[model samples]
Target: MTTKKETRTFNIENLNTRDGGEGESVIGGYAAVFNSPTEIGGGCFTEEIAPGAFSRAIAENSDIRALFNHDWNNVLGRTKSGTLQLSEDERGLKFEVTLPNTSLGRDLKESMQRGDINECSFGFIPTEEHWDYNVEPAKRMILEVDLFEISVVSIPAYEDTEASVIRSKEVNEQVEKRMNLIKKINTTLEAI
Candidate 1:
C-alpha cells in the first residue's frame, strides 16, 4: 500500500541557521500541525501527528534521512554528516537539521535564502486513520502513522485529499466488487 505524504510551507520566521564556524549550519521548522485542516490535492483534510507518533521509531533509532526533492540518493543531513532532529510540540511536529559544509548543504542553504525552497514534505505509513463522513467532503483523521523521510521540495505533491480519501474509497469499491462476484458464483452453484 502506498503511504500518504504531507507537505506544508515552513514558516520563514522559524527558520534559523546557527553557524557552527567554518561553514556548518542548521535549518529547521515546524513540518506539520495536529489539528489544522489543510487543503490537499483539491479536498480538505486535517491530520494529527499524535503525541507518541515518533516514540517507537525514535526508540529504535531508525535512520530517518533528510533528502532534497524526495530523492533517496540525495540524502542531506544525516547522523554521519550532521544531524536530523524531530520533536513534538503543542502545535505539531518540528524538525531541525544541521547541515554539513559540503557542496549539497551550501546549495540547500542558498536555495532557501533565494526563496526557491520554502516547503517541506514528509512520508508516512498510516497505522490508523479514519474519515469522518459526517462532515462535508469528509475530514480524515490520521490517528497514527510511521514517520519516514522529510524532504525539502519546490512544489508540494500532496495538496489535495485525493491521495488519502479517494484512494481509500477506491479500495472499498474494489472489495465490494469482489464480494458481489463471489455472491453471484455462490448463487449459481446453489441453483445447480
Candidate 2:
C-alpha cells in the first residue's frame, strides 16, 4: 500500500530530561486530533488519527526512529531497541524516548532544557482518509496513519498543541496503555 507522509506539530507538553545526564526523557502530547481541520498543503484537512491508527503499524514494526528536525541523516534514537517508547492515548500518540548519552542526544536535551525546542513534529504515512465537501472549502480527514519518525522542531503550525518535557512521572502513561488495550479489543471485536 502507498503511504503518504505527513507531519503534525505539538507544543512541548512535557520534556522529561535535560542535560542528557539521566539517559532518558519522556515526550508526551497529542500528535493529532479528530475533527480538527488545519490547513495543509494548499487545502484544508481534518486529521482523525484515531486510536487504532498506530496499533497495526506499531505491532508490525516497533523499530521507529527518533530524529532531529526530521533529518534522516541524523539518528538520535529508536523504539525497537528500547531507546524509544510509543503509544496512542485519548488525545494522540505519546512518546517516551531514552536519550543517548552521545553528543547529539546531549545537544537535544540542552535545547529542550532551554526551551529552544518546544514543538515536536511527527512524520507518518496516511493509511486511510476521506474527503468532505459539505463545508465551504473542501476538506479531508485522515482516519489512519503509519508513524515513521518523531522529531523536535522549532515552530509548530497548530494551535493549543503542547509538547513539553518534565522530570516527574506522568499519570497519563498508564492511562494511555489501558486505553490502547481497550481500543485494540474493540477493534478486534468489530472485525468479528
Compared with the true structure, all predictions reach lDDT values of 0.65, 0.62
> Which tens-of-lDDT digit does each residue in 1-192 have in candidate 2?
324365777665645553234545544444444444565433322334455677776777778887777777777678878877777666566676767667877787778777787777788777876654444344456667778888777666422233221101131343345456667887899999
Model 1: residues >4 Å from true position, as ranges? 1-13, 44-52, 79-82, 158-192
User: Using lDDT as the measure, which candidate wins?
Assistant: 1
TM-score of 1: 0.71
Off by over 4 Å in 2: 18-30, 33-35, 157-192
C-alpha TM-score for every candidate: 0.71, 0.68
- The sequence of per-residue lDDT tens digits that candidate 1 reaches over residues 4-93 is 454444433366656766666878886666776664434533334556665565456457777777778777766334488877777666
Given candidate 1, what's the lDDT at residue 147?
70
